[model samples]
Target: MIKFAYTILYVQDVQRSLEFYETVFGFTRKFITPDNSYGELITGDTTLSFAAHDLAKSNLKDGFMKSSNDNKPFAMEIAFSTDNVEALYEQAIKAGAIAEKPAEYKPHGQTVAYVRDLDGFLVEICTPME
Candidate 1:
């Protein structure tokens, strides 16, 4: 059976992206290439990887859409599960995340909020459904 191992985000700076995830979400930096072109975070079962924009360009012939400093964020998002949405949302903002929405409860029994990361990638902070 095929299993999901990781997801890579093409970023302008690998180290910076890794650090942002570390500071904002408490994820630990797992490894980074010596040239700083690739990195990953220790995010439990599925690894969150990052690749430098230049490296990504070299790897792809047709190129891929990516979130950028000047452009609007991509449609998709990465969601993180949390228990204390309010506190963690505030903490994420204080850590330099741009708040897109404050936490709110859904009929499904989940408290969810949205934020943009340093590179303008959408991130969702939400509580688990009971």
Candidate 2:
């Protein structure tokens, strides 16, 4: 069977990115390399990982677009489902995440909000779909 294990975001600073996720999302740290170029967080069944730009460049022959707050967010986003969307949204902003939208109820009865992480990655905070 095929299963999704983790998603790695290429970031300028792996340690900083890992810390941001831990502080804003409350995910515990799994480990970071001694060089601080790569790290992982124990985010439930699927791990959330980060690789430094330099490390990622070495791994991929071709370069990739870098995320930046100055630019519009990418087409994709990482969503977190939570019962307390308002509280978490507030906390994320306070923890340095840029608020994209405030929590609002959708016609489907879900509460959703958006924010950009330090590296400009889109993050969605929302209520679980019923």
Candidate 3:
């Protein structure tokens, strides 16, 4: 049987990324490696993890494209569900996130907004559909 356990994002600073997610998304830290090279958060069903860039390089011989400090965000995005999209969107922006799109009603009866995290990762904050 196959089941999704977690998703790891390669970041320059594992602790920093972990803190940002904790502050912005209210996710609690599950644990961080003793070396501080990797960390994970308790994000509902699937775990959200972050690994240092050096750790990623050691894991992937071919290397991977990471979100740049000055370049635009990557095409992919991580979506988070919330009951109050507007409030959460505002909170995210205030927490050093860049607003990509303001909250708006969708045809599917969902309120959705977009923002870019400190690492230039696209994040979609939305309310669940009926």
Candidate 4:
């Protein structure tokens, strides 16, 4: 049975991303590599593995690979669901995250907002419809 799964994101700077995640999501370090290429981050019941972009490219070479700066574009993102959307949104901004969309109650039924990480990965922070 699957107990849990972690999302691994590739970032340019480990410390910058680490500080952003830790501050915004309240994540605690579970483990960090000596070279800071990969690690586990825990917040509540979730564990996120953050890998440096260059390292991830090499790791994925066994499969079909593309340059991190390919012309076609290489990108990914993660959504952070939270209860106190407004407060977290404010905190995220204070933590140096650039807001892509202001928080609002969308017609689709959620209080949603968007922010781009240091590397331009979209992070949707939201609360489900009540």
Tens digit per residue, CA lDDT, model 2, 6-97 = 99999989988988899888999999999999999999889999999999999889889999999999999999999999999999999899
Q: Model 1: runs farther than 4 Å from truth?
A: none
Top candidate when judged by TM-score against the true structure: 2
Give, for candidate 2, the lowest lDDT window spanning 10 residues: 15-24
**Cα error, candidate 4, residue 66 (Å):** 9.8
Q: Candidate order by lDDT, highest to lowest?
A: 2, 3, 1, 4
TM-score of 4: 0.78
Candidate 3: 10-residue stretch with minimal lDDT: 67-76
Q: Please, what are the lDDT tens digits per residue for candidate 3 over residues 1-130?
A: 9889988888888888898899988999999999989999999889999989899999998999988647787878899999999999999899888889999999888999999887888899999867
Give the number of the best model, judged by lDDT: 2
Q: What stretches of model 4 exceed 4 Å from their correct place?
A: 2-4, 44-46, 62-76
Model 3 accuracy (lDDT, Cα): 0.90
By TM-score rank, best first, the candidates go: 2, 3, 1, 4
Q: Model 1: per-residue lDDT, tens digit, 1-130?
A: 9889998898888988898899878999999999999999998889999999889989999988878646777878888898999888898888778888999999888999988877788889999767
Better-scoring candidate (TM-score), 1 or 2: 2
Candidate 3, residue 64: Cα displacement in angstroms equals 1.1
Clashing pairs in 3: none
Q: Evaluate residue 11 in candidate 1 and report its C-alpha lDDT on the 0 to 100 scale.
A: 86
Each prediction's TM-score versus the true structure? 0.93, 0.97, 0.94, 0.78
